[model samples]
Target: MLLDHGERILTASEAIFRGTGTKLSGKVAGIHWHYGTRSHAPELTAGYYNTRFRDGYLPIASMFARHGVIFNFTCIEMKDWEQPGDAQCSPEKLIKQVILATRKAGVPLAGENALPRFDQDAHNQIIRNANLRLPEDSGNTTVEPMCAFTYLRMSQHLFHPENWRLFVSFVRKLAQGQATSNSWEQEHRDTDKFVHAGGPMVQEAAALLH
Candidate 1:
């Protein structure tokens, strides 16, 4: 969400293009921050993880937020940490980093997605700081089974637009009372079957949605 002087504002793709996490533009604010699930993922530079986060990532997030652009971030921890550097920071810490950076820039958190869920306190803090509501805990248990499969895809292939589309749609269905335990189980089995057979799992999932 975008805001001016604490009041809501409508921002379209054109205005949001600057915040889409690709490039930096003087005319736009906000930064797109993406991270892989593994520790020490090589998508960014090597051997300077802390520096990159503090000097590069946080600064960019801060700068964009100062100008009323929300710095969107996506981080997931789905597996064991592959490096000590990755283990040094908890998911909560990372979330705090982003929250702090954006707050410093005087804007609300643009958006954040953390797969497999974080600790309850982290969730609460996010909700509090971002002024967002959360799904009821009782409602969450029904969808817990799907978290692993979802985390698998997000960890391995979330950067792909098609995969993200399928994942988001499936999650939405779960949230909207359109999904059931049996259906999610079927979807998971179908995904596994298709992926194992080297088929396009996302497209297959889309067909399942219909």
Candidate 2:
């Protein structure tokens, strides 16, 4: 846990991007930090194993939050991580919880993801069972999973034209030069993945963003 002014303001894994094991914004002002998720395919960088939305989505979002971008957001993690589910209903309960949490905090929130179920331990075993090639995204590209500091994604109850437009413009700026390769460089150097952003969620938000 991270503290500021003697107050517990940040959780460990959620502090950074969850799956990517990224660091977070160092703030404890009780302000709402924003984040995003479920936009692109996993990056298979050296040592960097990019898990799908559920595994590292929250951590990635936290990275965005720390950068003074978006603060309030959520992603759904389903019960079975192996079987891919619809991003919309993957983590139904988690979506609701994040919405409630953000509202109680009185902050703006965005939901960018699909709902999917997954079990970490079971999935790990399955990786070997299925003989799936493990892609690492930490040092030199592979960042291990950091479960403690993950941010969750939520669903949209209503659509706001103005907000969508603003978000679209924002993501377009971030996505300007981002791609799987750029993300690979950042991960390999142990730099910052949040700096390099863009995905389906950003694109969709842009289309809706006025």
Question: What does the lDDT read for residue 48 in candidate 2?
Answer: 18
Candidate 1 similarity to native, TM-score: 0.33
lDDT of 2 by residue, 1-210 (tens): 121321233444354556674534331111111112343232222111223343333343344345433343323222234334443323333343333333333333433223321223322222221121222212333221111222122123112433333333333322332212345454333322322243455456546645
- Per-residue error for 17 in candidate 2, Å, reads 22
Top candidate, metric lDDT: 1
Clashes of each: 2, 55
Whole-structure CA lDDT of model 1: 0.39
The sequence of per-residue lDDT tens digits that candidate 1 reaches over residues 1-210 is 122312222233336666576432222211222343343343234322433434334555555554555455544222224224533444444544555544445554443434444233333333333432223233343222111111322333442444554544444443443333457667667545545454476556545555
Query: Which residue runs does candidate 2 get wrong by more than 4 Å?
Result: 3-70, 76-90, 114-210
Model 2 CA lDDT for position 139 = 31
